[model samples]
Target: MAQVHLRDVVKNYGPLEVVHSINLDIADNEFVVLVGPSGCGKSTTLRMIAGLEEISGGEIFIGDNVVNDLPPRERNISMVFQNYALYPHMTVRENLGFSLKIAKRPQAEIDKAVDEAAEILSLTPLLDRKPGALSGGQRQRVAMGRAIVRHPDVFLFDEPLSNLDAKLRTQMRVEIKKLHQKVRSTIVYVTHDQVEAMTLADRIVIMRDGHIEQIGTPLDVFENPVNTFVATFIGSPPMNLLNGVVRDGAVVLEDGTTVPVPPGYQAREGQAVQLGMRADNVMPVGHSLPPTEHMAQIEMDVNLTEPLGTETLLFAELAGAEVQAKMLNPRPVEAGERMTFQVMLDKCHLFDAESGAALRG
Candidate 1:
């Protein structure tokens, strides 16, 4: 029953503020991820929750207790850092049980906790091996096992997979998700990777420049981004934005190409806006998804093609800006080839050109 609550937390170094006052509540046994680009204050926020960094203002509550004044050891939390901080000289079992050992816990209790954590992470076979003897993924598992042996009220993971290779990172993502399902602990993970946030979190907290931009379930943020920054940051290949002005129930681009404003948006005539389109929403007519009721056709010359097995990402220029569209059904097309693509207007978005806020009715 460890629910974490941050009440307008703020962090400042001397006179410069790094983390603006931000509030968040994480439910018990929930997995939440704070994701953003580098220098977004995500890791600083996690460290504040862990009591590793002192808060400049506001209170932090772990369950029913105010932990703002508590030290790291008294916060009843365990943190798994990016670099697997395993002692080189200790075997896997010793490393897992080191915290409890240092705390002067009974040998029987320590052994039981270590054994259970080892079994859970499938590290029972590597208990006798040192960190140097284990692979990166195996070492990460050992790091997680060390955190689990403590059975703390909360688990904080700070980019725990960044050091691993691409394949191992994918594998570890699955492992971390499975671990959450098994342990059911309240987890607050921090990462700059959106894919990890989307795959691992029950809810995501997106931050920028020390301020929280948005917080919602992955699908909620993906399908309904609140602004242009979020619309571009949450998805791979980024969303294509075309600057235009609303005129006669349509958006007119710089090149005199007019497209109907996406449905549900109340745009005034003569209003400046940016039309947002994901690569998935724009595709070659023959290779596109089943047609939607509200669609717009546009012609563009392909500049490049990125064949990704079942699908290819087509790069083109639209309205003076580079645009990315997906090509389904697998086709070979030379550069500079002209193609007509369909845009799913129902899935498109409209944002205020100046402020970057979503234009919703």
Candidate 2:
């Protein structure tokens, strides 16, 4: 395994920069994920590493060698594309051994490597089958098997699971993680799906508008987002953000309710701020005593009740705005009924109303 480093990397199209000065260090055997919305330059960043896209500036290094001038083949990297590009005419064995054969490796060595990879990937039974006869998941394994046969320093995956169905994608995620554990190869994966990023990444790089927003572990970015954009982007049901103002060391909501601020907040009294709280953090106050002495409670009409089998998501309105709260039980509830709920003040996050930057306490 080899470490990958990107130094102030950039990409442009006639002065329209798609990837801005991105600097990142990926350690050996570390699974780093590049995640962002469409047009946010995540795919561009992956392509630059794979040598499929030209860099307008900066340098990329694989191990101790600078690969800025290298082509895709010369970069010594294996890429698994979203489409699982496999030659239909070649059998599974031939597809897995193509790269070695192109490099003119000995027949015995190629056979040995292919056989080993096949065994590890459970593709040995399909070795003689053509791509046309293989299932989608099997074809995907072939694509990965081809990569494993070469044993490159870095594995670059560009939304390799995008084309698969939801169930297949979930299955593939486990398979890929297991494969990584066995091989312990350095990986750089790109995906727009936050679930994939959170599940697969050792470190997540969240990008927006061709710039890096935040880079941290999944839990770090989820629990302590750097800004309002990240607060809303990282979670499934997203964090609930309400406009408020700091009043006498407390935040006053739009409905004129005061909520105490956490200790050590730098923002002074009367400053406009945004309050952020996760759905799970907003629970029925009486169910369990909250950790924070200062609690913020709101009375609102329940708009909908979604029973998710294991848990229930309550959609309600607070201060003329829609908000969601997740409950541990699939309790019964009705819409259009007023309900009072408490928010955990200690778990709440604050952001600057004007700048959207998170306010630290």
Candidate 3:
């Protein structure tokens, strides 16, 4: 295991700069996931760390050694690609042992490494099978096994489970977590899936347009996003953002209804602001409650409801903006009916309409 560090790292292709100055420190044996939308430069950053892409500027260090001039192999790092990158003609055993053979390890050593890796990945049963005969999940396991045999200082995974079906994706997610616990190697995984980022990463690096938006644990980003973009990105059904204005120390919607503001909100009266709230925090009010400093009331028009086994997802409209609410043990609700819901303003967020930055108290 090793600590990976990047300082002002940049990646450019000819005239197009894909990744801007990035600074990060990944501790030893930590699993850090880089997550963002497509073309957000998450993969580009990972490639740069693996030495697969040239770093246009800044320094990269692996365990106190500067490796800007080193090749991928020389960095002593292993990368598992999305497509598995297996040789179709080679059997699983041969594929896993190929690197050992190229490094001139003895025949016995190669066999031992391959066997151990296969055992760890549960690929021993398919050792003689070629890539042509393996399922997508099996092929991915082979790719992981290839990385394990070398025992590299760091493991880089580029959406390795993307090619599998939904069921297999869930199954393999568990397998990958288990593998990491057993190996305890430093890993950097890149993906666009927020669920994967939330479930697997020790900390998530959220990116946008080649820049880091927020770096924190999953709960931190989900509960307190720094901007509107992040508030809309990290949630499942996403947070409901309503266009409102700050007036008299509260947020007033377009329909003239008001919601309370938390203590830290410093918006001036009648100033334009966007109020952000989570779906899970939107609760249906069964009775009248005293107005609190951290609470706001709203009328939601039910558009649709989706039953998701344990909970119901309610689609509604508020202040001409689409909103969603997640309710536990939700009763049947009819469309076109006005339902009263309370917004937990203590958990609410405020963003500047123009700059999109969260309004600091």
Give the alpha-carbon lDDT of every model: 0.95, 0.89, 0.88
Q: Considering TM-score, which of the candidate structures 1 and 3 is the better prediction for this target?
A: 1
- What is the lDDT for 103 in model 1? 94
User: In candidate 1, which residue ranges exceed 4 Å CA deviation?
Assistant: none
Superposed model 3: Cα runs more than 4 Å off: 287-293
Cα lDDT of candidate 3 equals 0.88
What is the per-residue lDDT of model 1 for residues 40-116, given as tens digits with 9 covering 90 to 100?
A: 99999999999999999999999999999999999999999989889999999899999999999999999999999
Model 1, global lDDT: 0.95
TM-score of 2: 0.96
> Cα RMSD for candidate 1?
1.0
Candidate 2 residue 196 Cα shift, in angstroms, is: 0.8
Error of 1 at 223 (Å): 0.5
lDDT of 2 at 199: 95
| Order of candidate numbers by TM-score, starting with the best | 1, 2, 3
- Which tens-of-lDDT digit does each residue in 1-361 have in candidate 3? 4999999999999999989999999999999999999999999999999998889999999999999999988999998999999988889999999999999999999999999999999899999999999999999999999999999999999998889999999999999999999999999999999999999999999999999999999999988788898888998878788888888888888988788765576787877888888887786675323445567677889898898877778899888888887667667878887888877777788888777778868
- Model 2 lDDT, full chain set: 0.89
